[model samples]
Target: MEQGEFALSDREFNRVKARVYKEAGIALSEAKRTLVVSRLGKLIRTLRLNSFDDYLDHLERQGTPADAQDFINALTTNLTRFWREDHHFTHLETYVGQLMQRRPRGENGRPKLRIWSAGCSTGQEPYTIALHLLAAFPELKRWDFRILATDIDTNVVAKAASGTYPETELSGLSPQQMALFERAGGGQVRIPAAARELIAFKPLNLMNNPWPMRGPFDAVFCRNVAIYFDKPTQGELFARLGALIVPDGFLYIGHSENLGAGGGNFKLVGKTIYQARAQQKARDAA
Candidate 1:
């Protein structure tokens, strides 16, 4: 057990792959063998395990809940930044403006808006959504608006909940956007309370059935997440998301991802943007 010397046999790799797929719906291909080794090697050594088999045994037989979570955290890839795909937000502005004009106020005499940022890594996407909404629709302060930001990685969820990031991470943001952040000590910037208050960060696994939230959301940003799943899983996930969104509600995905067969309930409206079909609303009402 020298550093970087952990040998992962085919059997061991497949075992890891199967477990990850089963638990998270992430289909790890043969190309991911190197990734698995690199990501888990340190964890295996930290556990004082000499081989992948021993680590797998520990995970299956005697690992604590924390150990299981750490395994998923180690394997989960979270790469995100503010305005990673700028076009989505641009479309969102137009969509929301139209939605506000058409949708009636709630019983409380206030406009209600709910947007879900599924797979919100490190809080950037959700925060970006909040910032954009606040900047474009200043009246949202008087409305009932909330963003539900969820991710499978507890580590990232916790970081996101903190609403803090290195100043360097804000490089892409404009001065107007930068004004929304307060200077956190140690060269970090924290999201202003106005934007932070609009977001609720939680840990969620998309693979889990009967998702805990009752949605019917105005919009859903599940960007870049379904790319990790195989075709069937992707279809099922988008179908479920379709059921949760209101008719005419927007769904923004990653630029690289195509909804494919899963897109039956939505119609393409903009680049990587979709509108949940009005027929869906009729079906739900019926």
Candidate 2:
């Protein structure tokens, strides 16, 4: 990438970009060298460096786990909001209601509905799920629900787990839900203790071999994330997720993506959503 005669050679740029995609499923297009260089320029300047070569030398030799974290954090886009995909919440409500009705019991009497918000970024998504459940079903207090929120970026995971967000981030939330958020000193809004209690945030690299967590999730939300991976990587990812999700369980993906856009492990269940096959969730339970 050439900018005012200061260019990043193919090898140099690829070295950085490859490291990012390897760590996170995100691939940097050739068009994004400017951003890559611009972001990394801070690290260079912070280290008192003048050339990209020196930065590379440092990254290759002296970059610690902390550098890797900064590298991924800067490169990854963790923007998510409460009910960003509103339809998913509606679907979840309907699904959970049915589960509750079919069993004909209070929250405590019914089997737990396990959910995983993979690629949960900054924690909004999973908390949104919890709040939706709490608001829609007051009896949810009696039920045991677990929402696992995971991301490859530990920094974002920590922020998410803190359950704190800026006031402006509440714009997308409903007034009723917003009422549950409280502004702490310094203008930070914290997710209600109930909602925070519903989630378990952890660091998980989706591309890492031997996925650290296994699940029989009643539903899985893996939206807007696979779009960054190559087709093969995407396919493999869906396949792995398919195995973890229970049969007949729902799978929510990004609005812009489709089932098997990378490979076929799910059947179209809704608008850009899929199911792990009813047989799977049911048979597995049996």
Candidate 3:
């Protein structure tokens, strides 16, 4: 078949869908068939494969870790921008302020302020969080602070690590916010080293077992990630999230995502935001 003429049959599409679901916990509905075709088509063409079956076979035969990562990267949709949801940031700033006021200083030994941006795409979200924190509390520069920005897509993780974005990407941000951070030329901007220093980017598959870091994170920003997961998968992921968060720690999900029927130990506190229940946290600790 020619470059643009490659066809994806139902069998091949379903096979790919199953593989994606099994590996990434992303349930691709029938409506997403076109998306799969369009996105994977580029990969198939680049590999000069005639059909989706050929591409699947290549994936099966190679079975290299990198190949699997590539498969996920090709199909994953990463749509995000700096300060995409302003209210969330406002809430975050207030939360950080409260925490900062309480965090022990000097001889008292201040606890490290930690936040996790799960499914962080292209690094914008985490970078934005860093900037927000810096602007909210300049004194945070003296405290031990860290932001873990992770995504399943290795490519996006690399981009996030680079901390570079085009000027147009700053559309969601205001001039005042822009001015606070360092900027690079060529119609592109790089996150200031000060903000960048607070973040560490890593490639993470949410469905994978034995997560590397055991976190009692102060907050977890998992916006727009669980929508792709089935209800059961979403429940399990949130349960793990509950376990990883500190007592009363906040969990900020996408506007569309919710705790659902099996909300477990999370108490809905705001629009798409939940706080891990103190009672449940105590039980878990016991």
lDDT of every predicted structure (CA atoms): 0.91, 0.80, 0.87
- Tens digit per residue, CA lDDT, model 3, 1-286: 5447567688988999999999999999999887888888888878888888988999899757777788899888999988977788888898888987777664547558889999998998999899988988888988888999999999999988988888888776688888865568888888889999899999999998889999879999999999999999998898888888888789999988886754788998778878889898787679
**Number of the top-ranking candidate, with lDDT as the measure:** 1
Candidate 2: misplaced stretches above 4 Å?
1-7, 103-110, 261-263, 279-286
Lowest summed lDDT over 10 consecutive residues: which window, candidate 2? 257-266
**How many residue pairs clash (N, CA or C atoms closer than 3 angstroms) in each of the candidate models, in the order given?**
0, 5, 0
User: What's the residue-level lDDT of 188 in candidate 1?
Assistant: 94
Model 3: ten consecutive residues of lowest lDDT: 102-111
* Candidate 3 regions with alpha-carbon error over 4 angstroms: 1-3, 105-108
**Between candidates 1 and 3, the TM-score winner:** 1
Candidate 1 lDDT tens digits, 112-148: 9999999998999999999998999998898889999
What overall lDDT, based on C-alpha atoms, would model 1 receive against the true structure? 0.91
